[model samples]
Target: MRVMKLNEVINITGLSRSSIYAYMAKGVFPKPIQLGPRAVAWVEEEIQGWLQVRLDERS
Candidate 1:
């Protein structure tokens, strides 16, 4: 599975950094994995799945 940083997440989701954190806090977004003491990233497939769910919701 691919991992994506915050910048990529922002690009793919079109959400601001604050919004991303907000969603995470509300359990709406996927939780990120810790890459190191100061780095974190999300699973690419998970993000894609989340997008798919949103798309499905519009149907």
Candidate 2:
């Protein structure tokens, strides 16, 4: 259950900042697991699997 920060997610997903947040809001993506007062992270395995799913769909 590895976790990643927002910046790491951004670099990996290649999605814009707003788009990332929007996708989370729309439930199209996983919500962040709150860390401290101003920090958050997402499950790395979940995001990795999500990317794999999208790639599979495109193929």
Query: Whose lDDT is greatest here?
Result: 1
Clashing pairs in 2: none
Give per-model TM-scores.
0.97, 0.90
> How many steric clashes between backbone atoms does each model show?
0, 0
RMSD of each: 0.4, 0.9
Q: lDDT by residue for model 1 over 1-59, one digit each (tens)?
A: 89999999999999999999999999999999999999999999999999999999999
Q: How much lDDT does candidate 2 score?
A: 0.92
Please give the range of 10 consecutive residues that has the lowest summed lDDT in model 2: 23-32
**Residue 30 CA displacement from its true place in model 1, Å:** 0.3
Global lDDT of model 1: 0.97
Which residue pairs overlap in candidate 1's backbone?
none
- Measured by TM-score, the strongest candidate is 1
